[model samples]
Target: MTKEIEIEAKNIVTKDEFVHLCSSFQLKKQDFHVQHNHYFDTAHFDLKEKQSALRIREKQHKFVLTLKQPHEVGKLETHQSIDKQTMDHTLATGIIPNGDVANQLRELGVTTNTFTLLGTLTTSRAEIDYKGGTLVFDESSYLSIVDYELEYEGEEEEKVETTFGALLKEFNIPKRDTDNKIARFFKAKAEQS
Candidate 1:
């Protein structure tokens, strides 16, 4: 297992803005890749109540189980690599593996067994190095909803905000409030229900 502090600034953008950013950054077709995020939560959305989230991300034929919890500067992310078999078993049975991620959840007063598959969000994403941070472009679809987002991830929160803000201004894009992907997925799931 590995842990990190994730500090990022994000904004929702229009499809036209997404395309414009791609062109301005010189992002090629090959820079884009697709990934699927399968979210998990209890029947009562206990994790959401705690401002935490859990998911197994499938990318490049590999799987990773991650738990994101609140932190002072940003979210604390705990990641555990799992094989395809483990991912499949958890998806089919709602039984998370006993490991660091589960241990972390336990600290949040959540039992691993209580989690069930919530839903999946798939995104076509591309990342580029910009202003000492990683700038990400995402076109994500979940539960009949599709959206575009721009994100800047970096070690320095203030710099991330400044750089991201400047980028939007340069592109003539308005700054819009953007919820994280997991929250958006849960909201969409709830609306459908």
Candidate 2:
């Protein structure tokens, strides 16, 4: 398992804004890659209740299982790589793989056996190195939801926040009250229920 400290600022944007950002950043169409995130949770949302998330992401036919937990600095993410066969099996059976991810959930009092497939979110994403950070633009679709997002990942917290704020101001984009994609997906899933 690999642990990562994720510190990022994000805001929703319009399709025009997404296009404009790509042009402004000189990002080509080839820069964008597609990925599908399959989310999982218990029937009662045991993981969401703890502000945690579990997802198996497929990109270029590779699968990675990620667990995100709330943390003071941002979110603590634990990632484990699994093969396509494993991903397919889990999707078909609702049986999570045996590993640190499962152990972590068990520690949180979640029923590992009861985890269910939530839904999938697909995103076309482009990453660019800019201003001491990695700027990411994404267009996502899932259920009846379609949205664009801008996020900046960096180490220097203050600088990244300042840069992100400036970018939003420059684009005349308002910072929408938003959580990560997984949270939004879960909320959308709940609403449709």
RMSD of each: 0.9, 1.3
| 119: Cα error in model 1, Å | 0.9
With a 3 Å backbone cut-off (N, CA, C), the pairs that clash in candidate 2 are none
What is the Cα-based lDDT of residue 35 in candidate 1?
99
Model 2, 32: alpha-carbon shift in Å?
0.6
Full-model lDDT, candidate 2: 0.89
Write model 2 residue lDDT over 46-135, tens digit each, in one string: 888999999999999889998899888888888899999999999998888998788778876885665789889999999988898999
TM-score (C-alpha, index-matched) for candidate 2 = 0.95
> lDDT by residue for model 1 over 149-181, one digit each (tens)?
999999999999999899999999999878999
For model 1 the local lDDT of residue 180 reads 99
True-structure RMSD for candidate 1 = 0.9
Displacement of residue 28 (Cα, Å) in model 2 is: 1.8
Model 1: number of backbone collisions: 0
Note the Cα lDDT for every prediction shown: 0.92, 0.89
Per-prediction tally of clashes:
0, 0
